[model samples]
Target: KEPGSGFWLKWLGAPSCQRGSYAFYKSVSSRAQPDGPVQVWRLGEFYFIRCGPQDPVCIAEVTLLWEDQTQRHLLASTRLYFLPEDTPKGRTREHGEDEVLAVSRKMVVRVEDLVRWSCGQPAGWSSSLKLNGLRKPPQSSDSNDKNTTTNTTDKNGPVERQGVKVLSYPQYCRFRSLQRRLQDGARGPGLQDPHLLALGAVRALPNTRVMYCRDTFNHPTLESNTNFSWQFSEYLWSSQQISFRPSACIPFPLFV
Candidate 1:
């Protein structure tokens, strides 16, 4: 584990688990002391290795252990290789300031404002609201006092109350799934939020955004039959199997 020691990174696919008692995997390794600026390695169709000024390289060793009633065993091990020069080491280059487009910056238009303006009621319509730099308008002192009184009344009138709660990461996913459902015209009191209609419109627009999954909703739910620890263990293992990648969704937005 000393600095610059050779290391390994392994990627195992779920399809490989089909082997009755064995697992298949692929890995990349680095030379103990690479002399060049770039080192390249490949394992399978599922990965692309790139070395550039913007990316750093790291290597790790992976181990898998298994235990059974009869004995314990080391299931798998792998090494990963990379080069330090895989990152740029030379003099820096000069760069110019990036140009900003006015239209692109003005993309977020309020639906209500647009409707009123388009209906030829300039007097009734408010100025177009942009999503960027949006802030809630300040409330008047009179309204704040009224809200305080209303809150007091509601606190006294509530039939029952549970503990206050905040959404967890998985619950956020569930909320997004529910939003997708509501967008598809599902009936629910959640539709009472005026902004939900605009959200549904955004989801309905095609080729204009990057979405989590195009065909289905993904949420985390625990099985009632499993023990809490077992359920958590499964969730952790499944989460580790997922790999998130970043790439330009719209490579050339202006040109397109």
Candidate 2:
């Protein structure tokens, strides 16, 4: 007599008693009308389901509706785990004037976008609907290489640059140390910091140009021709003949 009484009957996997049951069953079998979309709702702390028939003897498919209203067909014979008692509850309620209701909630499994059907001869018989969570993209260790030279660029020029000498161990160590201190989580001086200025002085070597050094957001531009200058190459024991001048000097905050 009740609307959802059919659900109980269907869940019980028993033949309906009344004439209406036979009619409903026939409609489901003939037209293959979904009883209803798959739903996720919390009962107390756990979620329960009245998914479509599961018996291999039956001929109905189960479909789940996502938040975006996209429909996904689940594997016919897959077993689904309902929300556990410890799981957080979501807001959803039953349909009106019916013993059964449709609810909305997120799933744990990551369902594919396409719809799947049964593998039967007519390909109609199906079982419970499966729910899945969204998948995350993989992390990349090679992200730093994006700014570095690539194989294609190597063909245009020598793999190494000419007329540029490597920094001595002490000079390199000092520059690297200052860079680490600036990048460390600790709040330190801005570009005006004496340490940064000292590092800049050391980087301004004769015949050795610091091509560019940019921030993650590309806000601060520290290029060889800009934001850098030298009066003499004191580190290399040279003067007058070795004088540097940055096109411009701009100091920007490290944090927004």
Candidate 3:
């Protein structure tokens, strides 16, 4: 969210990222008058935020947290999630209650927008995709470690990870199909996609906001896939993917 000044006023200069807990976000869990054992915001953790009165509670992953030097506050960059019902092809009995479609980019949010940390069993895939280097790297066992492992039972059995993970392997297909679908649904199927306007000629529309997303270019969310780097044009679908592509009415800036 921005103020009426027509430019970003709070985050004035290049910000620095914190290591462990980052700065205090103080979600619903840590709202007590004194300190409590609430989990602080960390990279890769999933959280829920209600952006407005009528906006549905959406879930997202914390990608990065930077402290604005001028205003002395922490702001977050995230990858948004969408529910099965919100997708282009609506929901069905096959979708799990916890299932979601993940996406990235378009805005930087205030840490205050976070409502609560989403901690529970994550939706599973037939053959789990590693999503290896997107956020955390695979851990190698250390020589000093013991062979014993812990078990967490919830009437089902033990699980590996505890939160939602992004699955954007086929996102170019989603984005291209969605762009066509959105146009077809609005103006009938045979219509073409809207014309492309140069960055200078573009104007901010009614519901859009002015954003600066260049800062996160050096982030993992923007990292290129390792496997399909040098492929031919026809085989580019797997390589031409975007990190985040959800089935939600995502608020995006026309000019950013």
Q: Which candidate wins on TM-score?
A: 3
Global lDDT of each model?
Answer: 0.23, 0.21, 0.34
Put the candidates in lDDT order, highest first. 3, 1, 2
Candidate 3 whole-model C-alpha lDDT, 0 to 1? 0.34
- For candidate 1, lDDT tens digit of each residue in 186-214? 74555543454234222121111111211
Which sections of candidate 3 miss by over 4 Å? 1-31, 87-89, 92-99, 116-162, 169-256
Give candidate 1's root-mean-square deviation (CA, Å). 24.4
TM-score of each: 0.14, 0.15, 0.35
Lowest lDDT 10-residue stretch of candidate 2? 22-31
> Tens digits of per-residue lDDT for model 2 on 1-256?
1122222111112222212111101101111124433211111111122222342221111221111112211111111222111113321342111111111211111112111222222221112221111011112345222111111112243232111112334554564565455457432334443445455323221222211111111111111212122211111122111112121211111110
The TM-score ranking, best first, is: 3, 2, 1
For model 3, residues 1-256, the per-residue Cα lDDT tens digits are 2332222223322323223333322111222123322334544445444444444444566654454435544455566665656544566786544356544333345554442233333333212422211111112244111111111123354323333333233432343344354445543434322321111111112111111111112223212433212222222232122223221312221111
CA-only RMSD, every prediction: 24.4, 33.9, 20.6
Query: Residue pairs in steric clash, candidate 1?
Result: 7-80, 8-79, 8-80, 28-80, 29-80, 29-81, 30-80, 30-81, 30-82, 37-85
Deviating ranges (above 4 Å) for candidate 2? 1-165, 186-194, 199-256
Collision count for each candidate, in order: 10, 5, 3
